[model samples]
Target chain A: MIDESRRVSMDIHYEISQHYFKEATYLQNWKLREWLSEMVDEEILYWMPIEENRLVKDRRPEPTPDDAAVYNDRYKHLKQRVEQIYTGQVWVEDPRSKIRYYVSNIEAFHTDVENEFAIRCNVLVLRHRRDTQIYQHSFLKEDLLRKTKAGFKVVRRKLTIDARSVQDKNLFFFM
Target chain B: MSDKDVAFISGAVRMYRERRGWYRSVCNVFMVGEKSRMEMRVMINVKELVDLENATQAKKIFWDQDIYDQEQERIFGRSWLFLTHDSLIPKNGDFVMSRMGEDKVIVSRQKDGSVEAFINSCSHRGNQVCHADSGNAKAFTCNYHGWVFGQNGDLVDVPLDTLCYHDNLKKAELGLRKVRVESYKGLIFGNMDPDAISLEEYLGDMCWFLDTILVGAGGGMELMGPPLRSVLDCNWKVPAENFVGDGYHVGWTHAAALQILGGPLAGLAGNRADMPYDDLGKQFTTRHGHGFGAINDAVTSIHPENEEYADFMAETRGVVAENLGTPREELYMSHWNCTIFPNCSFLYGTNTFKIWHPIGPGKIEVWTYTLVHKDLDIDVKRSIQRQAIRTFGTAGTLESDDGENMSTCTDSNRGFVTRKGRMNSTMGINREGRHPDFPGIVGASFIGETSYRGFYRFWAEIMDAPDWEAIKVQNDNWDEIWRGSEFWSDK
Candidate 1:
């Protein structure tokens, strides 16, 4: 607990949080292509898995990355989704819903991997669609950021939502 | 009322629900123990609700609680409902939670590789004995009070049984309610009715059509699961009928996505005036409500971007032709939208399988699985899974387009006045008949509602029939309802 060497300094914390803030803006503005190009590595694994409440004996805290997910995507597929959304024809997103992502409780830690840091943050996503309940859910996301010539790029991102089953109509946006 | 009178009253409730939009408030009013009085108000003639001859269906069927209730008891209780696939629970003690109509059931693979299913509710207190969506379990122990049931739904143990009950407890008699289980080509189905016909008999001629897709390239298909489940506000029948034979919507509803994606189906975008409407494909319906519309040479339409999948299909067509026949070989190279009676549907080209589990009159839980040939390369299977998820998964592009329409179809009928209207399914009714090569009544065009007539024809039959015996009595005369001049007779 008292390892000062491992603890990230306030300067580094600000840097990481600021980068996260910018990414959130791109998503909120529906500039997903721009966000992906600027912040994500070409070989990144962006995943958000479905959660099930199983019995204690069958419970595993972390399901493998290869397990079934709502979104287990790579660069090409993600780019297609982004392009489709921009077409103003994907009905679910044509009249895009208003989404605001609150990314906070940021923590940055130094990992043993070379030039890589783990960023854990609590993201509260508030989404509003036509004449429906405001879908608000909190999820914890862990992203591994690697230092690049252009500041940083997410090499891996894993999101675990805190809901038994998704009740919303559609998840048309990235979390 | 007498038992017969109660049954008739229940049927009357369904007729009223189909003739007048019976929303939740209407259900709440009658659910307050005034069913006898409500039955008097809802004594509608069933013949008027579904005019099979005229191909008109009352709108109330979509959002009426009474009709939903009747469907659960009569249709679901009697029909062979899809439970789970063999690949999903392959090993002993492996179980997956599934639904039979509204009732929750657990499908478990026993040690002998035979499958068994039982209601998920505990016999003691009606609490769900198994809460997990899926997992391997030696036995499911009830979390509420520690009542343990074995893999085959046999009650194995009870805490304080001897001391609390003085050994009077009959554990054997208190097992979870069992269902009649059967499998056809690795697909397991369950029925609550002991007197219902067997699964093979229930599928009837639909099997000939199903064989083209389910059994392919020498190995059968497998469902890639833990299925993506999500709730939507829509009547279960809306999607069921759409999948059965609503090819008309594809060119318009998903026009934008199709154009943007740009595949073999892109010409359908914007409902282009000059598109090949007549030569698109064919539709079929069998003795059961099972039906499908197929488009020739567009098997991989949505994923036109995928070349490897196309190569796999091209390489395997000859083997399929050898194994099944030329008729099936033609089917193998086509895109299809199919529905198996009550609520299982899949697309052959799109390769997305779905179960629309009705939660209420106006809501359903959609469980989606990607279907793939078992013998394909793992990479090809993965690619198909990816494309399937992209097109029809919970948040898929094409799926979302239909979601809004399905919801509106149900909710808009909430007005009592709106339920009095009729929804037309008379698109190609007069142009379909028995085909020489195909087993069911075939339509000339894919973009027609011929299958809708067949779907509702059986829906009304099951809704009115008391048991499988009654269904069998009318089986010989089933095609008599579709009395069109045989269009395919010359072909």
Candidate 2:
């Protein structure tokens, strides 16, 4: 028989994993603004690839006192980008509209502090546009998850693409 | 044999020469006029190009086959094409695949620590010798015919040579053709011409500009690879010209991106008049056609939110000033949209280096690498690479926008009639001249077409000159076209 303490620990772990999984799904689904406001801390460091030794970093914009307005503004910008697919606002996405994303191979590791876990996963995205042409692309993402009072949230995320040349029509789909 | 008859003959010859010159000039003007109409009526000719002096209007140069073939011989063959950075092949036997025009070439570091490059095709059957993009190997063996070649381009052995030829075939004569290779600081370049000018002399005053980013702050730059490669259906010169000095596009083309990022450059999104347009920055074109459009005091435009990055640039500014002097020091702190003539471009402050590897008149395989200071911390390096990929890589936000424009520009010039018409690049025509502090002719603003003119001037020289010897006669006359002007003296 499972003890009460053990049951509680298992419940917490499951809850954290479920939340983290959902957050990752949201990000892959092009819901960054929602995910950002929901999980990310005030100061989140986003590291991206430059060529040689260079790195391009983007920190989350500071939140305003009018939280709804700020969230709405951010959401509108994201929506505009998403809406670009139909309106030709973003040319990269107009020609290629079909995308198939496979998010799997999830592994969770404990961080230095208790109640904090790091999640690493492999994502294989196959995109097709105009017709039935297969274009395979993949990326590896590492996420830091902290157990919050509301369950779990992402603290930081690092993404590394496999291909040296980004072999795609354009970067329309979020990785 | 009378003196009068002698004078008449001389006069007749002079008249004949003058008439020939006039006829050529008229034909050029007519071609330019026809090209301009073509740009408006149909797709501009992507490949067919006329003489620059004949081109009264800016003509699309991206889709012409004859022009592409000419470029392969006149420009790519003779010019010192950038191969790879030395950091990529630090150890002996290290090799990387690079492109010259449409041809593939392998650049390898020899056992003697010297670098060499050769056409990637096998000599026997014209099959590609090295299949992998990069690796460390003492020798490369052809997969098709089983021929082996040393790293320095010597034919080491062949499987059936002795058996088929009975020791009669010449092994030394079958080696791969070697290209002339040279490097400035850590950047390597390859040339196909045996009689081409030395790389340093070819680079000319552009070296001074290069030193600002290459050797500034007592810190040298290194390229982070493997490169991010992508194909864009556009004329290679479009991007080359854009990066060389078209800062005008940033505030307009990337308005949405800038609005979303909301940094130092966000104010440029709505075309705000109070954004200090006049004093924003200056544009420069060099003798060798290297040029840049800079945005003053906004080096970290892409990442204004990163305090650590801003601090790093600030810390390095003092060192750059001490090493390269004040003018270049100012350049170090500014965001530069720049291009090295023929087809290498980069954002100096943004730290993204790119080579618009031309595939044909209308197609280009863009190879992008992140540029960084060698002395920076590992974490910082990783961060820079990540951001570079995010913003400029194949899927980069900014890269995607530019790709569509490049493709449209190249594709629209496919019509025959369209190819004949000229497009306008006459912006700041009578306004640009020499300045006391700047090297090349200084245009009035960063958005002007002065550098474009400079590029076309060199392009014409290479296209028309029969040989290197022919090109030598125009070396001293380079500045003659811009003389007798004082437009930039006060500025």
Candidate 3:
């Protein structure tokens, strides 16, 4: 179903995937400042709306920005979170927890905006803390990546977390 | 002075303080089990577990499975539990699945525009019906055996009813078990115990405090949902007690987040600043264990994005003063962290409504929603929702800090010696008493542990009382412990 105008070159697709992997590397290594300042667009919209379990027949529309969400972040919100971690008073993160990021299934398309690609990807995050505490999270992400002078910047990201009731103590970690 | 009766109070408690003998006098009421299970909780010698006099609770209360089972039946079964709010299920046939203890319930709006709830289990063979979190459906058809249940949990159809067994199924007797349902303001709650007091009565003086937020400016409040759900590995009571009156933990526990956000409460980070803490707030506890700690002029303390919410409070406080009077007006402009007895809790200023549903003694499932005034501008409501979720939702900055403390507090009791150990909440032992304007025990400061004492006081009372009848007898005398002191008058 690829339209001729929107299809991207294979070379561009490979570049975008590699860029996403590097972005994941910054987050997995807790280089949150670099992730924000380098990889994210200043006008980025990052959100994770609460997913409700409704019947297939239910016709209610998906949640908008006004509805409940786990993470509804602007650059400032993301910056505050990063600064919070760096404050050295975040005891929970101090007894440093281990984390790994798995990114795959990249499908990129050219959008109407010049140099902006609409991308869909799958992410699996694994976290382990304090001896036996282990949690796995999966998400399907829809992102808009802008090819700017600084390289690919995530302009917008909307993640659909797979868990109906998240099993972890908190989802404070980045996805 | 009402103040003349201050001799009975002490700042340090070395032994159980003597006041009213109501608890010790009720020995005859402590019977056990199938003489109506609500009539007794044999294993939980609540007197030893929750020592209100010393303000200490046994560590085992958080780890013991026997106590957890007793709670599942006695406390959970006999208490009014928070269910879905009407806003979430506004239309007829709209329903949401809820949990009361381990029991799954479907709360649905009926054809007559009233709400009804019933166990989600299929009446026959005990299979689960209606697995969706929420939906609009006339009937829930169980995949197994094709049994169908109506919106009110009435068993309507069965496969081969006429052909199989010649219609001996006795369909009328097999409706999913019904729970007594009631609404206070717009929030709906369910009670499994037939003998439990009406929801309004169960709410007790907590309603007086609730009116400050719920009915201030006349529109009342509603919970925004598709709530954020997550698991916390801690005793249900751990968080319950925290919200009840653990203001002590906030500055230290949430310091980083507060520092990053830099709101009015940022001064509280690390408890480093020696500010006028006592003058800032007060704590309150009702007859039925419901309680709150309210900080003066803190309505926008935690909200870094607090313009619209602050404006709403500024506009509404006068109207609330005109309607509910000056005392309530003060409450309207304050930040509050409260628990509605056994389980439900919320922060009014922060607007994060929560329910700590017990999974076992050492674990809980937390359901979070946004609480906002019904008639506010949609944009303002969304702003409050966003801020509330950002601070207290599953992925919240502050919530992450709390999860570790809660889990460790419960997990500590896993040690044999630790299980026998006792935890102290005697922060303001002699500091709270009756107030002329406030309807319950008003404490010296919001940071004090008075509400925790009051909370465990009722926990002991309920754990000992066999049924609501025994509870009713002492209802008039519930505040006997504070009967002699006059913090308001003396101060």
Each candidate's B-chain TM-score, in sequence, is 0.92, 0.88, 0.92
Q: What is the C-alpha lDDT profile of model 3 across B1-491, one tens digit per residue?
A: 24333322221111232212334335335533234533333535678898877889998888888788788877898999999888999988999989999899999999999988999888877888988999898998987898998888888999999998589989988888998999998899999999999999999888888888878899899999988999889999999999998888889999999898787888889887687888879999999999999989998777866687788788888899999999999998889999998999999888999999999888899999999889889988888888889889998989989999999999988898888899999988788998888898989889899999999999888776667766876766788888878667956
lDDT of 3 at B360: 85
| TM-score of model 2 (CA atoms) | 0.76
Per-residue CA lDDT of model 1 for B63-181, tens digit only, reads: 88878877877888888999989999988999999999899999999999889999999999999998898899989889889999999999999999889977898999998999899
lDDT of 3: 0.87
Top model by TM-score, which number? 3
Q: What DockQ class does candidate 2 belong to?
A: incorrect
Q: For candidate 1, lDDT tens digit of each residue in A16-108?
A: 889999989988998888888988889888887776667667755656555557677787767767777777666666577889999988988
Residue-level lDDT for B411 in candidate 3: 98
Clash pairs, candidate 3, are: none
Candidate 3: misplaced stretches above 4 Å?
A1-7, B1-41
lDDT digits (tens) for residues B126-186 of candidate 2: 9998866677888988989789999988899888777887888688988888889999989
lDDT of all the models against the reference?
Answer: 0.84, 0.71, 0.87
- Top candidate (DockQ): 3
lDDT of 2 by residue, A44-97 (tens): 443323222121221323222111110111233334444433333454555545
